[model samples]
Target chain A: MTRNAPPPADSGAVRSAGSSGSGSSGAGRPGFLWAVPAAVFFGLFAIVPLIMVAVLSFASWDGLSDPEFTGLDNWRTLLDDPVMIKSLWLSVLLTVLGVAVQTPLSILLGVWAAGHQRNRAVLSAIYFVPLLLSIAAVSVLWRAVLDPNLGVPAHATWLFGDGNLFGTQATAIGVLVFVSTWQFTPLHTLIYQGAARAVPPVLYQAAQIDGAGRVRQFFHITLPQLRNSIITSVILMVVGGLTTFDTVLILTQGGPGSDTTISAYYMYQKAFKSFDYGAASAIALLLVLVSTVISLIVVRLSGYDKMRSTMEGL
Target chain B: MRKSRPNHLAGFGSLVWLLVVGLPLYVMLVATFQSRPDYAANGPLAFPEHFTLDNYVNDLNSGFAQYFLNTVIVTVCVVGIVVLLVPPLAYTIVRSRGRATTTVFRLFLLGLAIPSQAVIVPMFFVISEAGLYDNLIGVILPTAAFAMPVCALILTGVMRDITPDLYEAMTVDGASPRRVFFQLVLPLSRSGVSTIVVFSALQAWNGFLFPLVLTQSVETKVITLGLYDFQTERGVDTPGLLAAVVLSMLPILIVYLFARRALVQGLMGVGGK
Candidate 1:
């Protein structure tokens, strides 16, 4: 893709030429030397592992011993397996549920917190607690909090009159989504709050002068202004949720008929449990495809090209 | 006609929202104090009639002190390395935009795409060969390397936001590049540096797949590994487990308690930009 592209802007070329010009004449040799370690580090660690993953994905063998030539076999298995197909669907479902739940909740909280700058610090602290904790801690915390026999849900049922409030498959999925949102919303809230705060107070005042109520002002002034952050946070959450493991591994382990077994969990089981490295690599490749597609969609929907060019050039 | 007072719906809504958000945290804290029977019998939110420091004391005996230390060591080391390494690279990228800089950053961006799950198996072989297989540094090095991309990406965004004129003026005043970085850029980018700290800390602390798959011995286990041990050894001990969790969360919680505003500000600045 880069082959046919125009050269980078003339400014960079001019800068490099000027640096080289100075170095040849022995005027500005000091600055050029400092950039060496960074370039080398990036090449060694970042560049190499990526090429390795691509190479390994096509070969066949367990992670131990030697890998043999097996072109297209892994990819072919991914194309045909029904379980693989189902997990893909489940991964998509998790992403959708997470994004659907988190985006609006975070936007609302962000708007509310931004509206009251006095309490913003305290409110942000409260919301961000989950984000600070690890996924393991979150899983364990929720496991204890949601334990059917000994959890808060049981007590809530005692007060509200209960049988089994969360034993159903839908409820199980709902709980996972809820935990994900709890972990993520504070982050998006902060993003939106920043975006909302950046919006001129004059805009809100102007709307108020025009008799726009808070609700109307939110739709008109807040949501539109926060489009970029909202989209960015949503993309991050969706990508994360689809690939989620630690929480599910701790909470459900994809239990009750494997209802919560997203592609990520399925991939782990297939690779490690079933000893199907070929299948796992295929699944990994497919995940990359799915992520790439989703990211492309986000880029298109958010007009990220325009955003990047506009934001980066200055 | 008498006009009614302003509607209190917004105030009422916010109060309800706050309660909804705060209730789960209350449950976690409360659960840590109650005995197993009390927790099992009364449900998670019950006020413990017999409040106990026993859970905390028992946990201290449960081999978590080492786990906590390991977690701290790994997390501090990862964050320290990432902060020290990523900025110079990111600074260079921001200041000197060219084929080489962009190529390096794009490689880092690939790290963003390459999930740890994909790399876990190969990484095990790599770490074991380095004789760091069960060492804390084993987990530390790979996690830091993998995290470099995102950290560099965020730092580059921040460093880019600094006005180039500052760098130009410093150079004219005979400050070297490293001097300009330490004196002018680093201080100016305090928010960005703190953002990387908060971010890298969460990544290292929360990481489970690496530590779980790579490390075997108790001496190398971090908090996530400790929790896994909690699950296996005392799986039914509700209060003990919760106590351990609360203990695990304490350090980051303390950091967040003070700097959440900075974190939010950082997210807004780095992420949104």
Candidate 2:
């Protein structure tokens, strides 16, 4: 590999020049060539495909023929399609519900786990187990456990009713949200746990000295201190929720109808099941736009982009 | 630490959450060890009448062994590609003052926001046109590419923590960039290397969307996809289905048991993903 290439011929001369002026432009620095391989590789698989997605959004293809440019036909049809509109709403609903549910729950768990007690350590370790399972595995496990006949629903009919949870719209959506929260809250909790542990103790001491109790200290000190982590965790949840597919595929199959078919799963159906590559490309582009806009807005509002430089300073 | 009180409220809450997290896990485990008839008769939450390993045995006797092999190959290849490519890239992003290098860093930052689902449509076309569709190579390439931005971000963060004085000392010793990289940068960033290896390995091992879209044959089926097929194909066989689910996560569970700290750190780094 080029990583082991010999130093430039002037290296001895540059060394003799000494380290007094070893600034950003020093001769010891690697060239742009070092970044080429990753850049090209990422470009081929991520960037190029992204561009092709944009172009394909304007063309029609069915995986069996060449794509032909169709202008805004796909977009027009999507604009009028009720399922597309509903899918967008469902995506937003799931994302918002995910953030709403996971944020506070993980925050509480994270702060509680930040304690150094022996029992807390053991409990936190158990909480971390769900993070080990893949999303597909988690979904499959939940599906079987929630089966109306042989699973928990049969025994616990008081809480679950007839247990046709997947047969209705509300329960199906509830299951999607709950399953996601179950699988992902641990990751977010870990994030908040790290952040909570990093909160300086002197601040809490000052709060206590000022007659603030535990709850007050949490709101005044802990919540304010965890601002950046809150942003990061929420962004991850939103993106994960928007693009959630495997769980939906395994759990509900977007079912009872198109009730649980969020935009990401809908896009898969459009392209693969219906073979409407053009329409799916449009939905894909919409998803990219929605996530980017939301991410940028969050970054702008919270100054997260500026936080990157502060992290660089570390 | 503020040991102001026993915090009985928080303890109770934790126990409640423990049940929420633990109950399904208990069900999955117990069901996997029970015969199907026992499971059907007693329900998911009931104690098993007799323990059995038939579920796991049946799953392995089926196609799971092949899926495990395929997932292993994908994971190793993805991790290998990431290890080979990302260090050099992160090293450059840290050390190189070139304008292009900054652009490359920004590119990855932008890449961070582009989810893989957004490009699956064109990715299928591109992979097929390249004659790689329905091949493990098809899944490997895209998965590795998507994993790079996060790995680059993490490794660069780690490398950036190596102070300027260290780099200057190496420069003062007349070391070339390559020498400095191998001796100082690589050794100093050992934790970061392991973090990326664990991170990318998990991503490759558990990846679903790419394999779901790009590949079709049973030959290239990864564990996640195989589990999905099991659910759709033999969903009613709860024990067998849950056993496959357990099988899909076994390797990661072993890693977690042995290297809990490292795995936790690696997963925390996935916050950037």
Whole-model lDDT values for every prediction: 0.71, 0.86
**lDDT over C-alpha atoms for residue B181 of model 2:** 86
Worst 10 residues of 2 chain B by lDDT: B264-273
Q: What digit string (tens of lDDT, one per residue) describes model 2 on residues A1-314?
A: 24545334244543333233335437576766667888999999999999988998999888788889999999999999999999989999999999999999999999999889999999999998887788888998998999988889889989999988998999999999999999888899999999999999889898888899899999989999888889889988988889888888889989989999999999999999999999999999988887888677654664423423543332
Instruction: State candidate 2's DockQ.
Output: 0.62
Give lDDT tens digits, candidate 1, residues A198-230.
998888778877888768988998888998787
For residues B211-261, could you state the per-residue lDDT of candidate 1 as single tens digits?
987898988999888997797677789889888998998887787777775
**Chain A TM per candidate, in order of listing:** 0.80, 0.88
**Alpha-carbon TM-score of each model against the true structure:** 0.88, 0.94
True lDDT of residue B117, candidate 2: 89
| Model 1 misplaced stretches (Cα beyond 4 Å) | A1-47, A158-167, A292-314, B1-7, B173-175
Candidate 2: stretches off by over 4 Å:
A1-25, A297-314
Could you give candidate 2's per-residue lDDT for residues B130-215 as a string of tens digits? Answer: 99999999999999999998899788878878887788788777777778888899999999998898888989999999999899
